[model samples]
Target: MSRGVGLLLVVWLLACSGVHAQALPTQVSGSVSEAKTRLPIPGATVQVVRTKRGVVTSTTGDFSIEAMPTDTILFRALGYKSQRMPMGGIGLSQLVVRIQLVRDSVRLGEVQVISDRPDRAIINRALRNIKRPAPPVVSGAKRPPKPKPLFAVDSTAPKKPVPTIASPVSLLYDQFSREGKQRRKMEEIEAEQRAEKLRKARAEYNKAFLDNRGYTP
Candidate 1:
């Protein structure tokens, strides 16, 4: 009975160990960086070669994904070269990888673009063949002479007699008009002289006031 119990116990222990090994996940965690600078490369794609499972690196260029130990992980970025690394015999719990990607360069071929427009020689030839119209000619006929008068005519008429202020009333009216004009002219001249004098006096006062206050301007 003791021997049978020992055999059953050994079988049960083996079965539990197999179950634990099968439950282990095939996963990996890693970081991607630039090969030259060792700087983290974010937004890099980490995909399994034979499966649809993939993950993108975080801001720190760290990524984790589920993949078999024998499967390949591809890292791709916009300007960097693509890299493939096989997860060969890597432990599931302690798989820490640091992938460095090299830079990719693509050189384009030189292309010469030819225009479909006509050459300058062809344009000059077409212009030379064009015909231009001649200018119009003027008439040679002479103009007729101006007509002359038939009879002699008077160039001037007789002068009329000039009238003078012979009456007393007329003479008085003329004298009064002359005196009124003279009075108005004298008043205007006096008024202008008074204004000029006042302006000069005010300007002199302002200048003296400014000078007393020590103002140069």
Candidate 2:
């Protein structure tokens, strides 16, 4: 085969194996309706989670979204249930879906969340706060000079705080030192016991030796 013919064959093979992107932008248009009542839901926000792009439903509950590669659209309508619908797997597929959103039942006993702490009836009853007006600002006037005591009868007042051996940690440290000293004394006592044992052993051997010599000591 000629070189040009081989190159042509290679190009044809490559084109056959590869897939091309949609030559134009694809649009997916749809209407949102209540699943239970079949009523149109207006102002619902629809999003393509895969592409992070979305659109809102119109007054008539109609919505149009530009489809992106590998997109799964999620729809959220207030007072109605959310929905998800998959579109176009790898290639552009024309889609016209009628999304059904059901109104969520309001369960009075269900757990409710608030952005900030709301005053509960139980808490409001427990707290009794008095609202006081702000004091007038004194800009230039000097605060009345604190009046001096009219009479100074005694220079000293009884100590409010009973003389605490202010250094409690120092006392603890001293107690720890005393305990350490006691531990060392106990160690010395144990050593003395071992030494006494040795002395007794020597005395017994000497007595035995004297007995063997036929001279009692």
TM-score to true structure, per model: 0.43, 0.42
Quality of model 1 by C-alpha lDDT: 0.77
Range of the 10 consecutive residues with the lowest summed lDDT in candidate 1: 152-161
Cα displacement (Å) at residue 162, model 2: 98
Q: How many backbone clashes does candidate 2 have?
A: 0
- Candidate 2: pairs in clash: none
Tens-place lDDT per residue, model 1, 15-107, is 999767655667678899999999999999999988967999999999998886567889998789999988775546557789999888877
Tens digit per residue, CA lDDT, model 2, 63-92: 998775456889998776777877656455
lDDT of each: 0.77, 0.71
Tell me which residue pairs clash in candidate 1. Answer: none
